[model samples]
Target: MLSDTDLQAIGLTLRLATTTTLILFVVGTPIAWWLARTRSRWKGPIGAVVALPLVLPPTVLGFYLLVAMGPNGPVGQLTQSLGIGLLPFTFWGLVVASVFYSFPFMVQPVQNAFEAMGERPLEAAATLRASPLDRFFTVAVPLSLPGFATAGILTFAHTVGEFGVVLMIGGNIPGVTRVASVQIYDYVEALEYGNAHRLAAVLLVFSFLVLLALYSWRPDLRKT
Candidate 1:
């Protein structure tokens, strides 16, 4: 019953969420590992930066990012010089914004998993003459599968539901940046409650399923 526009929005949202989750996994891993194992004084500061999005308003964060990626900002200048053009109002812009906005959701769960694992597994792996990288990939990662799942689910869901950040960065260009959330907003603003309801209901069911999967498989991911 959904229109093509609605379907495109949903598909784009999935694409953005998927891209954001993957980037978070790659970027958040080292950060979480360091947070879990490091005794450095910088840990607190770095962790605070990672967790800042949780407390900051999405619009505020997005505004800063927009400014940074705008023509006058350094990011824009660098991108322009590199021929990458401006990032704002683009699909990749949404991905970048989603990554920053959903960072804490990914980090906290994975960091908790890594910390819960302790150093015992890595130490044991080392005793077997495994290299540090090998120990992490073979021992640490395998033991933290639940946490990775938790992080991925949370990140994907959060990105899908994002509004202010995506709106600021990507605008409402259909098939480009008009994701489900923005589409729903457009429906409401135009007094199209029926369409809004349909989209909202879809997201509602999806979110419920994601949470159900998370809790059913790893309730402790919810605890921390």
Candidate 2:
């Protein structure tokens, strides 16, 4: 049976994932839109930066983020100047780290969806004198619902499974930053294999169910 601390970890993990996915939905959409539609010279560079986490080791990214958000770092200085204090080892810190770590997961699918949409719909909307924003809200977004769903599901799941980045940025503070994965780690470290197995099984079953539903619900929407 899972203890109260274990339950807290699970709840915290869900909250973090939910918040991260929501942020990604809002922030990533415009980026994906630009990536799919623009022919700007800076596109390649920006895209590469967004995709960096896909290849960069989690610890490496977390290390740099920690440095950047440390007291001596510019981000830390700026936050302090603004009276926001440091970000590391807090729930919001986990949010910031998770956002970066899971960004590409959200953006890539939406970008692909927009690309697959082709130019015809946008062109048609323009022919009707629809402004860019209006057309995006009306035509492009409505048509790309599947893409958004894919992005949301993937981002949520990815954030839930995150360990290294969250551990580095948020530490193992219970209720504050001890998410499900971190909770599982603590169980194993304490030789509490029963607890570890229980927690791990929950995560495993969840991941499997999420993927199964995502894949089976709409096979034609996005390829796995």
Candidate 3:
């Protein structure tokens, strides 16, 4: 039996995950493509930066982001200059943090997919007089569907499970920033074990299902 607050937290979690996944797809695709194809010396550094969150503590990342979005911080000053106010403690702030936290989950799989593609298909497309952009759209993306699916699933699931980062920046504001993980934390802190268990169980089952679907999916073998 979920309380109204718990239900709201679930809904907010879904919304946050959905938003973060979509943003990651748009932002990570070109970055992954470049990482897969670039031979530049900067590739290693860029890739390392992209993968930093995987190794860095969430609290550390969240701390920096919190400062960066604070009223006097650079990001905060810039946004204020642009009249958008401070980002921390807002939905958009959560979206930005989630995107950073889940970035590697989205990029790595797609980058691997691109690397596995080899040069043969692109060369074939070249021979057909297909422009670089055309080949990327018509050839590269179609073949990379599996990677995209994996990236999207991983990003969404990771975002849904986020806690430390969201907590550090989002500040538990009910429908605004009180996500399921944070709500569960509050429940436990208040000795409300039943509520905590209910939410935790839902998240556990949801995450398992998402991963199961990702593993079972066979994009290459599917009849399109």
Candidate 4:
């Protein structure tokens, strides 16, 4: 049996994951496309930067994000100057952090898909007088559906599982920053093993289902 607080945390976690995944698709698409298609000397460097979070400790990333978004930090100062206030410890702050944390999960799969697509379809479209933009939207995007699906699933799952980064920046404010992982941490810390088990089990089941769906999906069918 889940408590009201547990439900709230679950809702907030879903909201965070959804928002982060959507933003990643919008932001990561072009970046992935470029990484897949470009031959520039900067490609390796840019891809490395995009993949940094995978190797870096979540606490390390979260610490820098906290500092950068603090009232005295550059981002905080800029926001204040713009009359937008600080972003730390807010719902939107969580979104930002989640996006950073889950970026590679979204980008890498899509980039790989693009690379696997080779040059044939684009060339065929070009021969038909289709412009670069047209080919990208009509051909490249449609063919990359599998990658997009994988990216979206991975991003959402990763965001839902976030603990260290969210904890470091979010500060456990119920209905604001108190996500499922944080809530479970609280439950355990208070010796509330039952509640912790309930929430953890829910997360485990949910994550398993998401990955199962992703793996079972047939990308080839999307083409037909």
Best by lDDT: 3
Screening candidate 1 with a backbone cut-off below 3 angstroms (N, C-alpha, C), the clashing residue pairs are none
The residue-by-residue lDDT of candidate 2 on 164-187, one tens digit each, is: 898788878999999999899888
Per-candidate clash tally? 0, 0, 0, 0
Once superposed on the true structure, which residue ranges of model 1 sit more than 4 Å away at CA? 219-224
lDDT of 1 at 120: 88
Overall local distance difference test of candidate 2 = 0.93
For 198-217, candidate 1 gives per-residue lDDT tens digits of 99999999999999988897
Per-model TM-score versus the true fold:
0.96, 0.96, 0.97, 0.97
For model 1, what is the error of residue 80's alpha carbon versus the real structure, in angstroms, after optimal superposition?
0.9
Ten contiguous residues with the weakest lDDT in model 3: 215-224
Worst 10 residues of 4 by lDDT: 215-224
Off by over 4 Å in 3: 219-224
lDDT of 4: 0.93
* lDDT for model 1: 0.92
RMSD of each: 2.2, 1.9, 1.3, 1.3
